[model samples]
Target: MNHAGPSPVPSIFPQFFAPGNGPTDFIVQDFAVVMIVAAMMMAITYKLKQPMVIGYILAGIVIGPFTPPFSLIKEADTLNVLAELGIIMLLFVIGTEFPMARLRTMGKISFAVAIVESTGTLLIVFFAAQALGFSFFDSLFLSLALSITSTVVTIKVLEDLGWIKSKSSTLVLGMLIVEDIFVVTALAVLQSFAAGGGEFSLPGLAVSLGVTGAFIAGVLVLGSRYIPRIIDRAGKTNDYALLLIVILGLAFGLSFLSTGIGLSSAIGAFLAGVLVAESNSAAVARILTLPLRDMFAAIFFVSIGALMNVSLVPMFIIPAAILILTSFASKLLIITGVLVRAKFDNVTALRAGFGMSTARGELSLVVVKGGQDVGAVSSTILPLLGVITVVTTFLAPYVIRFGNKITLTETKKSDGSSNMEESSSGVG
Candidate 1:
């Protein structure tokens, strides 16, 4: 055997500063700084009982090129790539946790609620954007950014309030699942439209929708039947390492294939998750993926903040304010009305409405970022949506709390009335 000269003792001090195939020292340093700042900000927000999403965004803004005290990042391209990866991971996790069976349990009522709320908000925001001198595409993209609510923020608030198991929360979550499906599907069609040159062509739009619909159907049908078996087999090996690798392979593989087919990588990653979720080993996959998901998701939010030009906030203040008000009011009222129409009580309707109204955080940012990526929307839309996301995310907990208090008081009064009636009957 040709003894490869006893592998020259590897340098104990590895080349930290030398040119290499991997990211440079500066990139690693920048990442460390980002994580440190993110941790500090998140800790502060946690202490203040606010969403850590706000902290992550603030940290990004602080370190971003757009902000004061000099930019921390050397080149944005690497960070952007990481951010894109982060988005893929975030959406993949969303797909895995998607309440497919739960949607069935809630039935069409939740779907109706989601459709009405999303449509109502979109139309209102679209017209508002048009009236404000935005381009047609800008208006359309703005409408989408405002229409979708942040499932992450909503669930966090529900958990904090110990209301996750409440009837209203259940309904709100179900409605959100439907809303997510609608938004993702819409994103695919819109991306196809953007690929076709960002113009309104009815025939092109139809073609995009048809292809997207067909693609989704085929993936779900075929993937559900086969991907689960692979997962089950992996699980059978009792090799967690192997299982994790397989899951990642599926996510990236499907994402690449989707892009190859001219669809957003997000859709593919999400679909990959959906397929994995169908498996008996979904719980295992989720457990294995959570840490990775959380890390990348944080990076995604930070990247969104970094891309935002805070100075432009003054310029888009009016539009941002208009959208915030229009979206909040439209979503709340539309959802409440629909729920009432669906036979839910007034208190329940109000609670669900308030729960779903605010916190347009992650998905909103994703949509606007996607639009910007495709040059379908103006650059200003990112900062505008950033403003909307921060404001709404900050207010989400308070809004849900107010709704809870209202329902609690109503319940107490109703209980009092019942007790009074019993006492009167006994006295009689």
Candidate 2:
């Protein structure tokens, strides 16, 4: 106050702008921890002959808030963004790999199987939840949550097993695609009910469906025509960055549009991938996008694991176990029966059913969150579903691998029986 002291030195960066001491720094630290832990876990899982997906999830559990020591992630929002990015990329890659011709060939059977399996699961789960003392609205939400298949887990296991190109893979992929569409519509209905204070409006539901269908049709018709041309041009430049930008632009753009219209961004991303695949440059795009997709996909699985609240698992263990068993058995039997009725051979039908019976994953979580948003279900349901998802996802790889062997053995036995009968008839 007395003498004029030297003015305080100004930092080159402001408090909010500091590189290593700001909120952004915390996010970076969190991500670094996640990656380091993930790497270590992945190594262990690899040595154990487990899917890397499981390793990523385990890593998340170790670092997640639900774990013991301390939460490594200070900014869950940032991690959630990364996880969502991972999902978009994963679906985009899947879309690019999808062949429209194969979808066309399997369309009818896929629809039949999807409809039957989903409807059957919904009815069974709804009644079961009611019997367990859940209210009608809560049961409806729970049933919807249980009806979906985890496309991410299923496809990852299938691809890892080198069954992605198998006959069953086609049906499994097709049914997933159909379910993706159905789930979007169901979510719309759920959102409507939630917004209406638990009162579902039939007209609102119809409008949502109409809007969704129109958006899809528009994307397919318009995007299918123009997207290929844009990709073709970008491919000719041979600029990997430009091509990636273009592809991501289309993906995220459609995804944004979808969410704006009350549907899942994933659906839009998928459709975008399908549209891009129609172009001559799809192969190049897929190749260039591989590393990006791999990174994000891993992050997505890890994020899913991080959301699990292990402490709550004890409270609903019994109900969760029952839900898991019912979900798995109902999906497998109903889907297989539907496929068999649609004239698919026994082996293919069973394999497809097995693949489809994995955890409900993202859609299930979404339904529970929606229920919470509307106060339709207790918070207890969230952790219950989370535990069920983890258990089912853990078991999926083993089920698909061994289920194939069992189906193949049965098929061989049937063939041998038919051969014996034919030979005996010839002798007669």
Candidate 3:
């Protein structure tokens, strides 16, 4: 038995690769097949009344670095890129739910809670990393990555549960938007530090902030005036009016330009949505994208599944788990603290808290990508983020369902208040 010149490298999955070959074969077979297996599992699990998101993640695990059936998808960079597009559309849809007035009426609580919650988790993770002896850059990456909450998931769940018209929904959406802004800021700062030897430069930072802001404002202003006409005219003739050529052209183009101004292209995309949200074309945009959003969005989720590497699991498992719990706690604390003091019931406060827990979109991905680009985090961070997004998105529906029940069951009939009995916002 001890006659071996060199021992075998004990593989996690032997059949998918040639004992040390690449995952090149998996792509040639089509990533759709990989997704099909994951989807099948999701369907079976969903029918059994389980959280199907977990199934997707588990599918990733099975098809990841460990399982033996299919391991040829490790080279799915193209799939990931499409999935990234999915992120933009995901936020686009989420923004459609927020409209401009909701942000204004929600008050500083929305903005304040987002800042408090994000900073709170950020500091905790940052300090924890420092205490654990991580370097400054590593700590920064860990902190930013850990603090993000899935705004897309939060809004989607709320919409699905029919709670988007409620007060807690308003707070959640406002704060989630705030959180999105924060994640963008964090990524920008990370990018600046990564650019080279300068610790801080006012001109660079200001230009970055100013340019991005101006771009957003300009798009919002210009888009508001022109987008409706474009939509209306195009609808009569183009037949593809919902996907406005001018708006799409501007959204992607401006989004590219926003990068020069220190903002993620996502801000441009979101602003594109905000502009339409304020105009007559908002319903048209929403109505058109509903089906396409579903299709592209699934590709996005499956692409995330395709990226999971079980090898990286050993490193991210603890961090991912820690970040998940801490992020949820921080959101809960800040939103609840702000609302409870404002004289809201515990149940409503808690629902507002749960709604703030989702943090999927360009912001979170940007953080991870920025970290990798800066050498602040490992390349594996990207796949881990994919895992996080898939897991959280899949779990969002249940959290939303529970939150609705908690808020509804705990609140009594309205007693002369202007706020609707089932609604959480005064505007609604």
Candidate 4:
């Protein structure tokens, strides 16, 4: 009964290339499915005159584990990692376009819109969730999650519609920046609350905020002073490959540093981009990075769809619908009202409102996940949140188009009035 078996031989080759079953085989298979599904869906959406972002998301849902007929992709976690890469790339590109000077110019109006929108949305959403039978913690989390807008979705749609550099877009982008700051503070406060077993911790909150503020100021001051000079030197080399490598390094390097400090990688990547933009080689970097950004952005949107649980939609349909309605109304009305009160033209204000109301994207998921980790959010609310996110994302492009039509009509009317006035003056 003491028969000894021969010890299994350890392979010298890498596991990725092993025979019979390779460790990375599933990754390749999943990636292939994602690309094929995404291509088909994007084509369909393109033909229908819709933003390709919608198509990407639809493709994701089709191959997603939550979808019926069985999951086509076997490695969702791997795909999600790629999606994070997509977010980093997209935001990095956006950051390149927004220099610190432009950001400073946006301070006054941007602050007003951000403050009003966040405070109003938080209060309204909190009360609405409470009325819908949500527990206090659930309502608090939901309100916090919903108060912020999706920077990726809004900016992507703006890029799709060729409004990325418009006046309204500038204002919207600035407001988003301020909202992101708010998100950082909110998360810190929530974490403090969690750490203290539901009791508020003012000192912890203060420290978190202080650290965050310091980190941002430090990066902007230090990076803006040094990173651009390094990029300029690399640009003088006239080597495309070298320039690209340098830019990529800065983007990812700063992103990693941000994550190390408990901040979002997107913010770090953006800061890196801003620094790079200050260099003479900014044009070359943007040109070299566009393809990579587009590819990653598509994957990011797809991953968002995959994360949704369509099966739970039926269970939380009512709650989701109520929340969606309340959120959309509050964001649209509050943002537009604030912009108008600040003396912005009605068309621009309306466009900004529509842009901001697009959806809850990556950040909401992060917020809810954080809450869950701390035992503050219930599993039941996730399905409802998913439903709300999906609906809003799907509706964003259409809303933007509607706003565009309104803008066009107004412009034409204004132009015609000017022309008529000129003719009358000439006749007199």
- Tell me each candidate's TM-score: 0.89, 0.81, 0.73, 0.78
Model 1 pairs in collision: none
**Candidate models: Cα lDDT each:** 0.82, 0.75, 0.62, 0.74
Residue-wise C-alpha lDDT for candidate 1, range 194-297, written one tens digit per residue:
87887788898888888888888888878878888998899899999999999899999988887777777888888888888888889999999999998888
Colliding pairs, model 2:
none
Report the Cα lDDT for residue 186, model 3.
57
Query: Can you give the lDDT of residue 186 in candidate 1?
Result: 83
RMSD (CA, angstroms), candidate 1:
8.2
lDDT of 3 by residue, 151-269 (tens): 65566566666778887787777777777667765565566555544366887677656665666567766766777566556555646654556456655665666566545555656
Off by over 4 Å in 1: 1-23, 408-428
Stretches of candidate 4 exceeding 4 Å from the true structure: 1-20, 133-141, 151-174, 180-199, 344-351, 359-386, 397-428
Error of 3 at 52 (Å): 5.3
Worst 10 residues of 3 by lDDT: 1-10
Please give the range of 10 consecutive residues that has the lowest summed lDDT in model 1: 419-428
TM-score of 1: 0.89
- Looking at candidate 2, the ten consecutive residues that score lowest on lDDT are 419-428
Residue-wise C-alpha lDDT for candidate 2, range 1-428, written one tens digit per residue = 11122222213325533545767776776677777888898899889876676687778777776666556666667666766677678777878876565456767878888988998998998888888887777788888889999877788888888889988888898899878667755765665556556655678667766776788789878877788999999989988899899999999998888767656666678788888888999899889888988787677767766766666778788888788888788999998888778777776777888889875676676566556545667756766777777678788888888666643322236446531111112101
Cα error of candidate 4 at position 59, Å: 1.7
Model 4 lDDT tens row, 1-428 = 11122212223334643557654787776677777888888889878876576687678777777776567666668666766687678768867876787667776988888888988998999999999899888898888889888777788788888888987788888888888657645764565466456755678667766766787789889888888989989889999899889999988998788767665666677778788788888888899999888788777767766755666669788888888888888988999998989877777788788888767766675566556546787766755776676678778878877765553322236446521111112101
How good is model 3 by TM-score?
A: 0.73
